[model samples]
Target: MSVVVKTSAIKTVRAVTFACLAFAVAFAAAPASAQDMELKIIAPAAPGGGWDQTARSIQQVLIAEKLARNAQVINIPGAGGTVGLAQFVTGAKGDGHQLMVNGFVMMGAILRNKSPVSLSQITPIARITEETQIMVVPANSPIKNAKDLAEAVKKDVAKVTFAGGSAGGVDHIMAALFVGAVGADASKVNYVAFSGGGESLAAILGGKVTAGISGVSEYEGQIKAGKLRAIGVTSPKRLPGVDVPTFKEQGIDLVLTNWRSVFAPPGLNDAQKKALGDVVAKMVKTNGWKEVLKAKGWDDAYLAGDDFAKFLTAEQARVTAVMKTVGLVK
Candidate 1:
């Protein structure tokens, strides 16, 4: 009787173990669970801009991952993203449903343009990705590489104009920094501001500007089509599959990288912040999201919660110092 009982006990244990394995297998194969909550992602620029693209990507991933039922993107364009920033700080207090897409460009615009609603007034949710700005010239241009561009800029900074996004934006800042790094006066850089890359592309193609500065992705299509020549990228290393070398590699010591990220409105409790951060954190880990990053030509620079807030502080100081050096701020 004792032998029979011991054998029965072993059999029972094996049965339970098998059941657990089956359950695990079923869970792994199940579809992503649907979330009931919907959220609003604000793109504080016109449609077809960087912020709008980021916001739309977030919406796509959030819904496809079933992290949110829907993520609606709203565009509020003006004042280099400050116009919408003011509304977020004042109206979205304690509302975790609202998120804004901004980047390194905002820091310059806020300082140089003297925006009333600074990033400090909002909640820093996450740093999503970083992109390298590119120095591009039209296919017909004489400037062939970063060295050639440097010579042109140093010859007469004002005569060698850079066409890019709005004033005080990352494109503008990159052009200024490149000029300053090459012994040219940063403040003297002839930066022609436009609302979007479309406008800048047209100007560059039409020979209205000496060169163009924008995200490498912004010029990828034209570069591939032989419409534009990418001289150098602001990245520290050459990007894979892209022929352009780094600004450092081209004998220019300047390295300029712009970040794209999300922020929430102030007045949220810790739980609310956690919820938003968790959603983004999960979104980043998904295979779909990883593919999105690859397709969009953005590098993974994900940081969230307390660490992100600290990053905001450091970035504010760093950008402020650069602004002073470039004479964008007094």
Candidate 2:
């Protein structure tokens, strides 16, 4: 009877071991480790804006893929994302699980806002997506294409009041670049700044500005409704679904791809940066991430880890030069 009881106990232990092995195999094949805990993603802008969308996307994917048990987006919009940058630089030190969504706009924002804490203080995780900038005019206006706008801008740089967001944001930079490309003084190009896309849209629709510069995605609704006519897209080639020609195709030697990126707080060691970057790189390769990019009309421009850090340094210098030349930064 003792031998039989011992044999029964061994059989039960073997059975439990087999079950545990099977579960481990299944979990490994799953999206991500189901053991990860909560994560925090900060969107340094108002809700429903581009930064908000990116943070929320990170939140959604992390939770849905079981990469994290929970994730949240904290909005702190002001001063064109510099307000949040300042706080993050001082507060998020040594935080391994925190991230902030920032990009080309922030490059300009930092210079314009004159933030005490610059982007150089943070750690770059990855560059996720990029979009072509587009120039548009009110539907009722006479400017039809890139050539027309170029001629007008060349004739009187200050006469064509280009409207965009923030004094040094991508919109402002693109307008200045366009004017410079057309043989005009970029410093003399008149650019009026709005606090948000909604305000810029209102001004454009109300004919309060001569032309508008922004991402193609932001103006899709108005462009579809026949309220704004796209003059040119600042891409080497025309983007899919956008009927406008590229600035290059219009005989304008200009191309600019505004990219968005993810950055972590300072004080992370090399290992921590690699771990954080690896997760985001893996996330971008997922099907759910591809679907998110498709829905947002953003092109995948993924560059992770060291490569992204190098890119950030180069971009900072390039934009600084351009901004100085355009007189947006002294």
Candidate 3:
């Protein structure tokens, strides 16, 4: 009787094992299961900055369009965006639910911070928009136009110091390119880097710095308040209603615009990648999103995921070449 009982028990165990294996196979072959996904819009800077504003705008548009149940905008600030980037790479890697709203600043951070993961490591979802850079000075600075500033800098490269939001950031790069065009040794020019646009603007307004190289949107309010004077914009054509001249018009050619884009972690499945790209393409079409673009003075530049990826690669190559000329890269 004991021998019979032992045989029965072994048979039951074998049957249970077979059932578990069958379930595993079924689950493996099932469709991608994202019954509900939490979309995290990571703003690489602190609150109220351009990246933060972008993430919030995306969150609002995504929810308003009913594209997702909920989207959260979280601010992860540090290391010129490396802190947030590292957090994203370490935590939500390949979890299709997470998205990062990054700008070209990430490239500068990668070059400077020596981050383990660069922008190329992530999947470029899409580029939302682009904004032209503007040259600004204190409200009452004697330097009036782009030529005036250039003459002063040419007289003595260190006579006027330039301030920017980040070292080797978009503004810094623009400044370097600007000085380089005017037969000036850009390396000899005094360039100061503050934490963000706010601090840089403050330094300029306090007369601590002679001029500032920053995004037009950063000092848009001060421009309105008559506290900041925009002498020149680094665009081929002048901006609408801004009364600012282009650097080209002054015979100092320099055009550098920054773009905002979304990226996901590496190793996403085809379906997961397509789903996120679809949401971005759809979100850009909404009236609400368009209004945000207009309000922020961003150009209506939209590119699909794959196309945007190509653009990033090309832009990366162009920037890499430029940086090499300036000794910023190998």
lDDT of each: 0.85, 0.85, 0.81
Please write out the lDDT profile of model 1 over residues 1-330, one tens digit for every residue. Answer: 353458889999999999999999665433233396578899998898778989999999999988999789999988778889999899889887779999898888888878888998998888999988898999999999989989988887778988998777778778878998888887777889897678889999999998999888888899999999999999888888888989898788877778989998898877677778778889889888889889989989998867888888887887787677666799
Could you give candidate 2's per-residue lDDT for residues 199-310 as a string of tens digits? 9899999999999888889999999999999989988887877789999998998888789889989987765666577778778888888889999988999998678788
Model 1: CA > 4 A from native = 1-34, 325-327
Measured by TM-score, how close is model 1 to the native structure?
Answer: 0.84
TM-score of each: 0.84, 0.86, 0.84
Give RMSD (Å) of candidate 2 vs. truth.
Answer: 8.2
lDDT at 151, model 3? 88
**Poorest 10 consecutive residues of model 2 by lDDT?**
26-35
TM-score of 2: 0.86
